[model samples]
Each structure stands twice: as structure tokens, then as C-alpha cells.
Target: MEVKSNLLIQMDILGLIQANILTPVVLFFLLGLVAARIKSDLKMPDAISEFLPIYLLAAIGLHGGLEMRNTGFDSMLIPMLTAIGLSLVFTLNHYQILRRLGKFNIFDSYALASTYGAVGAVTFSVGLSFLKNQDVASEGYLTAVLAVLEPVSFILAIFLTNLAVSKQIKSKKKSLSSDLGNNEKILGMVDQSKTNLSGVLRESITGKAIIVLLGSIIIGYAIGDKGFESISIVFDGLFTGAIAIFLLEMGIIAGQRLDDIKKVGVFLVIFSILIPTFNGIIGVFVATALGLSLGGAVMFGLLMASASFIAAPAVLRHAIPQAKPSLYITSALGVTFPYNIIILLPIMFSVSSIVHNVDGSINLFNYFGIDL
Candidate 1:
């Protein structure tokens, strides 16, 4: 019993670091950081840094779509909805926690919600890499789930922001007290169009990230088996090379951010770090109960545990401008993003094995509504 307990505890710690440390993308990121710190002349063109994500997203989306094309529509729908649902729940949960912390207001809460709602491409990339490293199999359509979840969570965050605004307007007129009035003024914030659900959705669907992914999927689907055979040169061949360059850029960016990470308060920082870890643990239990494969379980844990910097922050800028970017950005980029991409995934995989060992007959696919 003690050995089992100790193993569980070790798995938890390994999970935390696994999310942050083991991936190749992170290694390249570290290399970039080291190069920058040492004053090496190495630099990614700003245009390239901006454009590479587009390529990455497009590649992932296309691959997912093509895979979905093969899987047919029926098997693909459930997981997609589950991904969106999880995204919404996680976003709202994170926002409420931030609000109770009292350092951020309603607008900030919305912005923060959107941010935590979406997924990180870099982190996802690393997770996929780990799957490949372990020779594990997962549904190809998950890439589509990744794409869909990004937009849906973003919309939910905006919806919450709008709700907060309505509540404020109603509260402002009800109480005639000076303190309440003061609170109103304090809570009042500028509204950016980016915060609107419609606007955020439009941006998400048409944005460079989604566009690339969708376009690639269509192309991949159109060509089918012949396409995979032909384009294997670029898609399979240069993928690692592209990723290395991408991580090198990420490393430099992360290192730059690390320089000022101290500005974000300890409470917020701890929350950012622990929340994902907590989510991953819960995910493990859910996956175990559902009887998912270890690969699927780990990926599911990653989806639940990962937070977004791109989709959420962009929306927050318009919907909740009053929210401090430092809290979300620093937390997501500086703390959670790094931790999950580098350390958490492997640990999740290991723990998943143990969970499955005790429950050998688990089969999540046959049992619906299990909350994986």
C-alpha cells in the first residue's frame, strides 16, 4: 500500500514537470533562451515568428480534417463537443477564481476566462511529439477538436464578459449608496469589440491560425491517400525541422518573458501553476473511469490542463480591457504553458498506466457520458 501511495505521489510530481520539461519544442525553446542570454547573434525574423504559427496551425488542421474525412462524421462529433464543453467549464472556473482573488475585476475576469479557455498551440505540438515518441496512437480528429475548442471557449469568455457588464449596469441603479457608486466606478471598464462573441468567433474562424488549419485539412482531404503519399516530403519530412525553428523562437520569447515574471504576484503565479496540475489529476481519474487508452488519457489530461495565451488574450483586449494582462499572460505564458509543455505530459502517461492497471475492463468509447 505504501509503495503504491508513494508511486502515486511521484507520478503527480513527474506529471507537473513532464508538462514543462521533456518535449523537443521546449528543448529548442531552452536553446533559444540560452542563446539570447549568452548574446548570440541568433534571431528569428519577426515576420517568420509571426508566420510560423500560421504554418503550424494550418498543418495540424489539415491533418486533422483529412483524418476526420477517413473517420467519417459520426465518430468525430462527440469528442469535439466534449472538448468545447471542457474548454467552457475550465475558462469559467478560472475566471471565478481570479475574481475571488480580488486583484482582478469583472472585465478582467472575462479576459482571464477567455485566456484560460483556449488551448496553447505550442503545448499541443509538444504533446503530439510525445505521442509520437512513445509510439502511441490517438484519434487523428483531435486536431480538429483542438481547433474547434479554441473558438468556442473564446466565445464563452466573451459571453461571460457581456454578462458581467449587464450585472454592473443593473447594480449601479439599484443601490443609492456612495460606496456602491464607488465600486461601480472602480468596476467600470472600457469595452473593446474583440470581447464580443460575434467578433471573437469571426476572428477565430478567419484568423490566421484557424484559417491555416482548416485550409490544410481541406487540401489534405481533397487529395486523400494520394496526397499523403505525395506531400509526405514536406508534411512528414520537414515537420521536425520546422518545429525546431519554431521552438528556437519560442525559447527566445519565453526567456524574454522570464526576465519580468517577478512582476506577477505570488498568489496569481501559484494559482496559474497549480490549477493545471489539479486539472490533470482530475483528468487522470476521469480517463481511468472511462477506460481510455493511456495515450488518449494523457492527451485528454493535457486538453483539460492546458491554458491559452493566443485566443483568449486577443479577445480580452477588447471585451475586458480593464483586466491586467500580466495576470493571464504571465501566468499562461510564463508559468502554465512552460510547465505543461515541458514536464506534465510524461507524468500523466505514467500515472495513467497505473490507473488502468487496477481497472482492466474500462472502455470509455462504449460508455457515453463518462466526462472524459
Candidate 2:
């Protein structure tokens, strides 16, 4: 039964991905990419381009905020903490893997790691839509998880980078300890102070993307249901269109960055695909332990698999200016994001379904003596 069920779930998820891929939102993104490749002069006006992400993030955050208002925090404390903790772990581990496997310098590795570690709100939004389309119910509070996780990987990544930088200073200058040079010691102090956790916290949380996302979440929470419903005309009704436009912009950017694929190469590309799967499986176990519904488990895994192109870039612009934009951006949006959206979501949902069902069957047999 387990094996048969697993096979059926895989087929079902593939069907779902195929069906959802044709939506206006995804289609617009494809359109933008094609237009860019053909050089048809398709471009978002700079003013409007700047406005779209804000609108989409606000819309998505408000939705999650509304959900949080619907579901109070006391009941969600365990899973919420689980989600946040796992996200942090994923970010830190991602940096380690990037450095180990990809040999990326401290700055670039951490930057890319943060990019992967952070959840992609857009991808999460789409995952929600996927669940909705299948009429699969998920916990509303997962949106809150998305909001809280947006800045986690970036901060953790920065911390990782700082740790590495400090270590490199000590390793390369181990002699400085015996030399007793006041000048060298003073410089070392400055470097260690630069890696201070407080500084990373500030820079990571202060990025425009983080600020906007968290701010929207707060505003959404404060407004509550009644207030949100009042503004649903703009935030709710037009949310899809805003996302379509945002993705259109993203598609163009991805196309422009395609040439950088050679820079990413095989090892990093392979790393991009695997890291999400690794973290996503960990998320599954965590969510499962939290007693989330099957759909909730898949959503958790989706958030795990997804990488933040928007938030990471916004923060990394300042945090790791030395990191190549193409390396991280292209890897996140071009490789990891696409892989998660196209392939990983369904696989996650299928795995969650299997676990949920197998668990249900075990409980049934234990309680009622019916195994079939």
C-alpha cells in the first residue's frame, strides 16, 4: 500500500505542477523571458518596476498577517519556533556547504548561502496557490512563518561571513599574538569588532526588503480581519496581477543574467539544487513533529526549498558588496527558485502525503484494527 500510494502521489503532483504552470502569473514570466531573449524591447518602466515588488510583498504579507490574526500565536508557538530555528540552521549550514563544496570565498559563499537560506515570499505565495488549487488545506499561520523567515538567512549568513573573516585574520596572522605589535593587535580588535552580532542584526533587518516585508506583516496584523477586508479591493483583488508583473520583471532579469550560468558552473548548480532538498527534508520532519496538516508540511518544505532573490539581493547589496550579484542572483532566481517551483514543490507534497497517510493508517490499525 505504501509503495502504491507513493507512486500515485508522484503522478498526482506532476499533474498539479503541469496544470499550474499555465497560469497567467507563470505565463507572464515566461513571456518576459522570451521577449528579453529575442530583444523585443519589453521593459517595465523604472518607476512601475520599483513599485511592483512593494505591492506584491505587501499583498502577500497582508494575507499572511490576516491569517495570523485568524490564528493566535499561543497555539502556534512550537511550530513557529521550529520554523524559525530550522531556517537559521539552514542558513548557517548553507554557508558551510558553499564554502566546502563550492570553494566560494567567505563573502560570496555567505552571500549565496543567505540567498538560499532565506525563504522566497513569491515562491511561498505560489506554493499556497498550488495548495489552494488542489483544495488541500494548510494552516494559516504558515504565512507568518514566511514573514519571520525573510531576514533570517541574511543575518545568519552575515554572521557566518563575519566568523570566517575573523578566523582568516587569526589563521593568517597567528604570529601576531607573539609579535606583541600594538598596531597589529589594534587592527585585529577592529576586525573582530566588525563581526559583532549586533552589527549583523542591524544590517540584515534594515534592508529595504526586510523592512517592507516585516512592516507589511505588522500593518497586516494590526489591521486585523476587518481592516484587511476593507482594503481587500487593492490588496486582495489585485494581488495576482501585481505578482504577474513582478514575475515578468523577474523573468527579464533572469534572462539578462543567463550568460552568467558559466560562472555558476556544474558544482555550484548541483549544490543549488541539492541544498534545498536537504533543508526541505529537514523541514518536513520538523513540521511533521509540529502536527501540521499534510498541506502545511508541504508548504513548510516549499518554504525551505525556496530561495530569496528579492530579499537577499536587497541586503547583500550592502552586506557583501564584494560578492558577485550574478553568482547569487542567478543561482537563486535562475537555478534554485526555478527548481523548487517546477519540481520540488510536488515532490515535497508527495512525500508529505505519504507520511501523513502512512501515519494515519498506523493510527487506524492501532485504534480500530483495520490495516487495509
Candidate 3:
């Protein structure tokens, strides 16, 4: 298992920058930071930014579902399951590893776990863009995996944290019951401490992203090979354009949060990059094992290896309030995410190509999903 150091990896990344697709994402992100730093009026409108993610989720899901339809159930089902399950397992594993680095206790662990586990849609989109730009082929079905992975990780983290919270409550039962009975006012107040993990899991399962992705998947599958031709000309054609605008908006948002990023410090910042870097590396191995193409493997690796700032943080706010959102949010959004999108993806592609060479052939039947 000797990893080669090939110059092709460098070339691919440099080419991406030269192509001008990724640079804008990076530069606009920087611009947002600068704008926020200087307090400039230039800002991504709140409504637009909010809608941008929804558009991205919908587009990615539709594209993936349509692609999956072309591939048929046999090609997609296994990989989709593999992607979601791995996403859940690895996210929690990363949280356990990350716990030692910060002051994160069990509650904080759940919050951070979900954050590290989930993949950011923007980052995944960047990987897709890179693969397309290089003329490398990948499964559109993988997008369904991406959609599934995001919410499941959040659900798992909540379950783990709630279990811990429940244990703590049990330990204090006698005293806690007395205190609860004495405080009539507090008893009537909203039970912020209550951890209805099951309910939360149900909600996350039926979340907006999942709903759109599932609905579109059904539509795409029903349409079969035609691939929503009538509507795709509008939605599919404008997909990339929409993505660019969204990234620009994301850049603005990231820029606005730059000041808060400074509080994250050297160690956390290093971990942010390294964790995803590590995840990407592991993803290469997983993709290789799964027998995916160079393109599909890299994309899959990137998805598994990515961290979620969007869905995870939103869940953490409700599930683990004591955990500092700043640490998780800033780390994912400000650090690992951008690094993965700009640099890691190309490097991953090269790794995938090298691995595929071990037994060079088109193995389109297998992909990132574990079952596949």
C-alpha cells in the first residue's frame, strides 16, 4: 500500500485554478471575508443566500436521480446504502478522535460529531465540477448518496448525545426529581434539557434536503431515460450557473464570519484541514475497494471525507446547545470545506486514477456504496 507521489496531481489542481471555475468560489469567499472585515456594503442578500442552498440541493438531487435512473436500480441501490451508512459511522468516529483536541465533553461531542460527519453540499458540488471539467466520468446517482449522508449523520450524533444526557439524568434522579417538584415555574418552562432523540431522528429523516432529493429521485426514475427533458432544459442547463452564484454567496457568508474564525485558533484550524484531509485519504481507499472509476472514486472520496457546516450545525443548535457553535461552524465553513473544494479534490482525483491502474478497466458496475 505504497502511495505514489506523482506530478499529475499537482497539474490537475493547477489546471482547475487556471480554468477559472474554482478561483471565483475561492476569491468570492475571500471577498466576503474582506467585505465583512471592512464592513463593506457589498453583501449576499439573506433571502438569496438562504435559497441558494435549496437550489443546490434540488439541482444535485435531480441530477443524481436522473443519472441513477439511467444506471437502473442494480447500479444505484447498493452504493447509495453504502454511502449513507459509512457517512454515519465515520462521522462519529471522527468526533471521538476530535474530542481530545478541544474542551468538548459528551454534549459537545455530539454537536461536533454531526458537524464533522455531514458533507457540505457546496464542497460536493465543487468535486462534481472538477470531475466534469477534467472530462472524467462519474455516477450521477452518487448525488443521492450525498443527499442521504448529510441528514443521517446529524441524526446519529443526536442519538449518541441524547443517550449520554439520559445517563446523566438518571445519575441525578432523586435530587433532580426533588428540584423539579420544588420549582413549579421551572417545571412548566420548556424542557430544553429533554432529548427526544427519536423525534429528532424522524424530523431529520424527513428534512427538506431529503424530501427534495427523494421526490426528484422518484420523478427522475418515473421519467426513466428521458430525464425530465422538458424541465431539465431549464433546471439542468442553468445548474452550473446557479452553483456559481451560490458559491459567490457562500463566499460572502464565509467572509462575514472571518472575524469569528480568528477565535478558532491554530490547533482547531489544523484539525479542520487535517480531518477532512484524512477523511479524503480514507475515502480513496474505500472508493478503490469499491472498484469505482477514477472520477467516481474521487467524488465519492470527497463526499465521505467532507464535513458538514450547514445541516449539522442547524441540528446541533437544537440538540446540543452547550457546544460552542463557533468552533464547529467556523472550523467546517471557514476551514476544511474551502480547503477540500479548492485543493483536495484534484489531488484525490489523481489518487483515484493511480489506484484504478492497479487493475485498469472500466468497472462502472461498482462504486462508492458499500453494498455495491
Candidate 4:
């Protein structure tokens, strides 16, 4: 019986991996990667590249809004709050690890923390697709959770960066007595470090991505069922195809950065994989404890696991100019993104399945027939 159970667990894991790998989304992504690796000339059109993300974001937000109308706000409140809490914790923890253990400078540490702490929209969309493939149901408000997680993590990271820069400037100022030239430079840095938090907050809220997503959600809610019916064909029908194309472009881009993986070092490569896995497991357990459905729990885990290549780079490039884009971008886009999509997604799904099992008697030990 024990051997049979272990075999069953292995078979289940293998089946999931096979199913995910064969999906159109993953296949397209792999095609793009191959194209890039071999130096093929395949490229997504510039116009389409710009258009796909907006369309995807709008579709997700609108669907979520419609779902929210059906589910009501009360059901979403706790989850949103939980997402915010997770964002803060993840950011702080990542900063400490990157700074202290990884021996990175403050700017690089905070930049990376922000990048990993924030959720990826594309990854979340793919996770939703995975759930749909598995015939799993999830909360519509999970879209709202994605929206909340991105900004909260970024804002906290930016604030922390500012504080660290200010302290570093003060320390430099004290050490310099007669070096007027150096003191002047330190003063300039101090001014820059005093970046307006309120301004960043406003920008984050009003950014194009946030605007499209939030606006679409509002439109969706206001429109109701009949209104959704009118536009469902475009938003719902084309979403998967759009994602496949988007990921194709993503794969090409990630492939271009493959060489950068060597530049980022083995330590960071390992860091990118391990940290997100830890965060993902925490997200899964938290979602289960909060009584989420298996699909919702998996989605939550994906969001936690995914690192923001888009939003984080945009913000951090301006806010933390000193941080190396090569480091953060390569880690998030080149390593973490692929790992989450190809490997972590199936693992999260399986883990969530066990946690949300009907009898609550199913677990790794019992499922694998481990007596200990």
C-alpha cells in the first residue's frame, strides 16, 4: 500500500507537469525561447507588444469587477488586507536577506526586494489559465488582490530606499570636515533622497497599468451581467490567445537575457529560485488557512511567487537609479519568471489540492505513504 501511494504521488506530479508543458501558452513561450537561443529573427510586432498587456489587464479587471459584483465586497475585504500584509512582510524580508546575507548594497537590495515583492500580471493571468484548464473555480476578487499587491510592495520599498539613502548621506556628512567638495555632493544626494513619497503614491495610483485595470473593474461593476454579455466575446474569448502571444514575446526577451544569468552569479540565480518558492509556499498555506478554494489558493501562491519585471523596473529605474538593472531585471525576468511558470505553478497546484482536500486527511505524508 505504501509503495502504491508513493507511486500515485509521483504519477500525479508527472501528469501535472506534462499537462502544463503541452499547453499552448507554454509551447508558445518555449518557441520564443528557442527562437531567441538560436538567434532566429522572430519578433512580435511593436504595436501588438504594446497592445497585448493593456488588453489583458483590462480583461482581467473587468472580469474581476463583474465577479466582485456577484460576490460582494465583504468577501474580498479580508483577502485584500491579507495581501497587503504579505506584501509588506515579503518586501522587508527580501531586503534584509539581499543586504545582509547576499552582501549587496542598500540600493540594489531594496530594488530587488521591490521587484520580487510585487506580483506579475502576466504570471497571474497564466495561473488563471492553468486553473481554467484544470476545471478549478477561483474568486474573481483575486484580480483585485493582484492590483493591491503590486503597488503596496513597491511603495514600501521606495520608502525604505529613501530612508536608507538619507541615513547614508548623514553618515558621510559627519565623516567629512574640510572636504567642502565632497560635502556638497553629499548634500545633493540628500536632496535627491528626499523623494516625495506622496508624489510616488499618486504616480503608483495613476500609472497607466493601474488606471486601465482599476477603470476596467469599475466599468465592469457598473455594467453588470447584461453589460458584460455584450463585450464578453472580445475580453473573454481572446484572452488566452493574447496571453500566448504575450508570453512568446516574453520568452524571446528572457532568452535574450540568458547570458546575463552568468553576470548575476550563481548565488543570485539560486536566490531567485529559492526565495520565491518560500514565498509561494507561505502564500499557499495562508490562502488555505483563510478558507480559499484550491484554485484561489494556487492563484495566491502564483502571485506570491511571481516577480515583477514590468512594474518594478519602471519604478525602480527612476527611484533607485544607483541599482543595477542587470542584476534585478535578469533575476526577475530571466530566472524567476520562467521558474514560476514552468516549475512552481504545478507544484503550487498540487500543494493547494492537498491542503484543500475534502476530508482534510490528505497531506504529503499520507499521500506519499510516509509513516514518519
How many pairs collide in each candidate, listed in order?
23, 0, 5, 0
Error of 4 at 181 (Å): 7.3
What TM-score should be assigned to candidate 1? 0.81
Please give the distance, in angstroms, between residue 143's alpha carbon in candidate 1 and its true position after superposition: 1.1
In the range 66-134, model 4's lDDT, one tens digit per residue, is 988987767788878987898789989999999888999988999899899999999988888877777
> In candidate 4, what residue range of length 10 has the lowest lDDT sum?
363-372
Query: What are the TM-scores, per candidate, against the unseen true structure?
Result: 0.81, 0.84, 0.84, 0.92
List per-prediction Cα lDDT, in the order shown.
Answer: 0.68, 0.75, 0.71, 0.84
**Rank order (by lDDT, best first):** 4, 2, 3, 1
Q: List where candidate 2 sits over 4 angstroms from the true fold.
A: 1-11, 171-197, 358-372
Worst 10 residues of 2 by lDDT: 363-372
Off by over 4 Å in 4: 1-11, 178-182, 358-372
Q: What is the lDDT, from 0 to 100, of the residue 244 in candidate 4?
A: 93
For residue 35, model 4's alpha carbon misses the true position, in angstroms, by 0.3
lDDT of 1 by residue, 1-372 (tens): 334434534545555465446556667878988887777788899899887787677666666666667865566676567667767777778777888874577766666666766777767766776676656655666676677776777677667767767666667556635576465454454222224567656767887777777677778778776668877777766666677788898777667777667887677678777888877767666655544556667777787788887666676666566777767787787788767767667667766655655233334433432443
Which portions of model 3 show Cα errors greater than 4 Å?
Answer: 1-24, 174-192, 225-227, 358-372
* Pairs clashing within candidate 3: 29-251, 32-255, 33-255, 79-369, 82-370
Give per-residue CA lDDT, model 2, range 44-131, as digits (tens): 9999988876777777677767777777666577887878788787777877788897788878888887888788878887776667
